[model samples]
Target: MRRTLDRLYDGALWLAAVTFALIAALVLVQILGRLADRAARAMDLPPPGITIPSLAEFGAFLFAGAVFLGLAGTLQAGGHVRVKLLVRALPEAPARWLGAVVSAAAAALAGFATWSSALQALDSLRFNSVSYGVVPIPLAIPQGVMTLGLALLAVALVDSAVTLARGGTPAYRASEARTEADTEASTGESA
Candidate 1:
């Protein structure tokens, strides 16, 4: 039973990663298209691509989507920058416990927010709310992607907390992988 749920955590993290990449690609396409248009305009020609999105709005959504999806991986890897001074001073067990508790709270809050926002975004899309532009599309469509990222973050957090509570170290935590990779690279060796 626990294992089934555990899959959800890791799976969600993977989902977020893929989603973030997709959002980034979407944003990049929009940017390049605009740049092409600018180059065309300079040459006294029509913009190559027709504008279908409010670049500002879609860009914002892409950012939100990336951040939300990336948070779980960030948290797992201890990439979340915090004041290490205090935690580093504590004994090992205490440090671990404190980290677990804080992470649990953070996960809960983030998950709840994402779930709520997703629902609202869905409703907005249903109401046929279209953005004003040359090619009008519903604002809620892109927001839905952001919502997916946030929801995944929450799932990843819960997975981490549960695994820690069971005395299982999350893959992202202080692991031997970093040192091993460094040693191999230093020795000009392949693993």
Candidate 2:
């Protein structure tokens, strides 16, 4: 189960990376197309008018998808900003409990977000909503991706809460510990 969950998070992260790469590739192509037109004009030839239809809209949608898809992976990787002063100050037992409580609360919020996003996706699907662009991209597609990302994030937070409640170090905490150890090793410090 643990391995499966880790793979799921990793897969989402990979997909997010691919999505961003696609965006970059598309932008590069668009830029190249513009340069081609410019070169043609400089040569006293007719311009090719090679412009990406609704490039801005496509970029925006892909950007949104990438951001949403990265949420769970970022949480698992300890990339999310957390105020750890209180947790670090407390005794081990109290700190564990506090972490569990906080994780649970965050999981609840993520769950709510997942629900709301799913609803929005469904509504868009029902209405057959499309973006106001040269290419009629379905609004539901991006909304559905957002919903999936929120669902994964909620699962990750719940996993953290459960692990903490069971007196185990959650993935994020373990990641942070590894990072701290690496930092200390490099600086010749011990804690």
Candidate 3:
């Protein structure tokens, strides 16, 4: 079951990357069309009537979408950066315990936060709340994507904690520091 979960997480991360690429293409088209139409108006070469998306606003929105979705993959792949100053200083035994505690707490907190925010965003969408836009997009969509990443991060965190508590982290040897990145495609034995 855990192996299946891991595969699912990896697949979702790949999906997120694809989603980001798609958004990028959409934004590119939107921006180019708007700019072209506006340019024609400025040159007085065509009818001075053109109303398209506000490139700046759309750009921000598109960027947010891409980032949130992309984050899921990154987080799942364990590409998120972590500070290891204290962990590195300690010897193996103590460091292992400390790492487990930290990982568990971090996972629980991040997961809870994301879950809560996703619910709230969903409610907002249901109620048709509009923030600074003529057309309101359902906030839940992107928020949900961000929540997915957070959930994956939570899973990774918990897995790390379990392994650390057992004796050592799976991807990390006793002496060296393994950046969370390597865990994305873990090749070692499971804890």
Question: lDDT of each prediction vs. the true structure?
Answer: 0.69, 0.94, 0.66
In candidate 3, what are the lDDT values of residues 1-191, reduced to their tens digit?
Answer: 56876676667656756766766776677667778778888888774443444545545655665565455346544466768899889998998898888878988897887789788778877887655655555666666666766666677677778878888544333213354335644756353
Please give the lDDT score at residue 102 for candidate 1. 72
In lDDT terms, how accurate is model 2?
Answer: 0.94
- Model 3 residue 16 CA deviation (Å) reads 2.9
Candidate 2 structure quality by residue, lDDT tens digits, 49-80: 87889899999999999998999999999999
User: Candidates' TM-scores?
Assistant: 0.65, 0.96, 0.70
Candidate 2 C-alpha error for residue 40, in Å: 0.6
Provide the lDDT at 154 for model 3.
72
Clashing pairs in 1: none
Candidate 2 runs further than 4 Å off: 189-191
Which stretches in model 3 have alpha-carbon errors above 4 Å?
Answer: 38-62, 70-72, 75-78, 168-191
Which candidate has the highest lDDT of all? 2
For candidate 3, the per-residue lDDT at 9 reads 64
Question: Lowest summed-lDDT stretch of 10 residues in model 2?
Answer: 182-191
Assess the local accuracy of residue 104 in candidate 3 as a C-alpha lDDT between 0 and 100. 86
